[model samples]
Target chain A: MKEIATYVERTFESVPDSQRKSEIMQEIIERLEDSAGKLEQDGKAREDAINKAIVDFGNLDEILQELRGQETGKGKALSSLWFAVIGSLLVIALTVFINLYYSPGVVWFLYPTFAVIWWPLCIFFFGKWRKGR
Target chain B: MVSSDLLRGHLETILLRLIGETDRYGYELFSEIDGRAGGRLVVKEATLYAVLQRLERQGYITSYQGDVSGGSKRRYYHMTPLGKANLEQGIREWHEAQEIINIFLRGNIQ
Candidate 1:
């Protein structure tokens, strides 16, 4: 277990962003500790449990996969929500500008214009976000 | 004896059904499957975890860390409401597919 922790820490040290690496390492350690404790409870010696866990988790692919899933979901939600709000604001601005320059009746077109513009903007950002993820 | 593919469907259904009943960590889930399958079906640890991860990613289930005791903290998985709907759909689909295959296998001409 200690060796596993050390290995994770060492890998994290090489990462440029401290915060992200820490978050990733924490989850990796959490999983390793859980597995090691299980093996110990099943009657294996402490050292044996540690050895087995480190050996089984020789590569960090599974841990990386979990982190990737979490990051993608968070990234997608954040991008979509922010873009939707910005797109709505842009549409409102355009509607106000048109109303000011010409006639106030343009205000009635606000909702329809917003929908027409927002849907495609939303879809574009959504597609881009999904692909980036 | 059920074919491997059929058995895989049974495994997914059994796991989803058991998690629906109660949130359980991996080990407990394994025992439940063993009990329900009457020792006829057992999932490999790797395969079970892989499935659990996929189900979770699909929003069919959710999991969280439970109490730590004597050093080990278990992460328990539970089916979401969406999981219930998904399970039902999967069951219906499997039944339909099985019917089609079974008819051909049995040579039951109508």
Candidate 2:
């Protein structure tokens, strides 16, 4: 049961921290314990019951897919990628508008946009990646 | 036994039926479903969560925290009034499908 709890918690590790997410994590853990308990009553060894319960719950990827479908939080990696893309487009448009209006004679827009966009993005991505662990 | 793919489409109806008589917690509801199917069919816990979430989202059911079990609280689901109407429609469709399939199975005997 303890192992199952740990495994279930680890399975939910990537879910953005939230009250509902934690509740579901606890629900999953409780369900696993109930499952294992029933198997034990049916004459299975403790370890075997735990193993079967975990296996019956399905794999992490499948669980994640199911969770992502229900969880409105969205995936951090995917959200970050979208942010990067949209930010780039906005920056590019700004750069062109700035260049065309000011006639800098060069695409010096890249330099400022690079700093303006990339720094925040770099910091954001690094923070996200670090927090993911 | 129904394939999981087929089961996916009917899960909402199945859940509605299961909750019709008595509200039940996630584990109990799923275990009863598996048992009533004579072990020929079983729903993965993860998939069940997604279905339950969808049902709740659609206002077909509502969930509430229940007494603790195994050191954690349980989530019990109850069918909404709208769910009862949905269930009736689903059963009607099911009966129609069953009759049509039976007729096909019987072939041009008439």
Candidate 3:
């Protein structure tokens, strides 16, 4: 059992630290111990049971790739939305500054501001659609 | 042995159905699948956990830690209402696919 726990911890060493990572590791170790115990109960030698249990757990790389893929996908979508939002804000700020400096009597920045708002709105909807996919 | 690729699409439904039957821990779920398949199909633990995580994230399932003998705890997964609804839809689609595939396999296509 200690061997199984150590094996799980070592395997997770390459994974970036996070609450999710620790939870996954804990769950995996418990499952491996359960499997090893059952194999031992089936009359296999303890060493053999532990080895078989580890083998049957399969490659951690595949799981890591999956986890990374999900994280990257989510990050990309969120970052893109943030980029749109920041870009829109910058554009609006520039427009407001020009309007205030050049045409202090006219208030026309609101028109361009409406158009700028659509940038983040579109990106937000796109992010939602991508996530649904 | 069943190809993992072929099983991948239905794996979620299979898991949902299993969990819908009763709450089970990770190891117990895998053992049930292995037993039901009679060793003809084996789902890698990595893949199983990934699918389980996806299901939980999608709000189709929830998990809680349950105490077992020997003072140990196990994370047990339970299907939610959304999962039951999804399972029903999955079964409907599966039946439809089966019926269509049978037309070709049985040479009944006109």
TM-score of each: 0.50, 0.64, 0.71
Q: Which is the leading candidate under TM-score?
A: 3
lDDT of 1 by residue, A14-49 (tens): 335444346446655766677899999999999899
For every model in order, the TM-score on chain A comes to 0.41, 0.52, 0.52
For residue A125, give model 2's deviation from the true position in Å: 27
- Report the lDDT tens digits of candidate 2 across residue range A1-133: 5798788778778876776667777777777787899999999999999999888886556545555665544466567667776877787898889898898677677777767677457756776787698
In order, candidate lDDTs are 0.71, 0.79, 0.87
Ranking by TM-score: 3, 2, 1
Best-matching candidate per DockQ: 3
* The candidate that achieves the highest lDDT relative to the unseen native structure: 3
Candidate 3, superposed: residue stretches over 4 Å from native:
A1-3, A14-20, A34-50, A65-72, A85-89, A92-133, B108-110
Model 2 chain B: lowest-lDDT 10 consecutive positions: B66-75
- Backbone clashes in candidate 1 total 0
TM-score for chain B of each model, two decimals: 0.81, 0.89, 0.92
DockQ of each: 0.10, 0.31, 0.41
Docking class of 1: incorrect
Q: Cα deviation of B48 in candidate 2 (Å)?
A: 2.3
Score candidate 3 by DockQ: 0.41
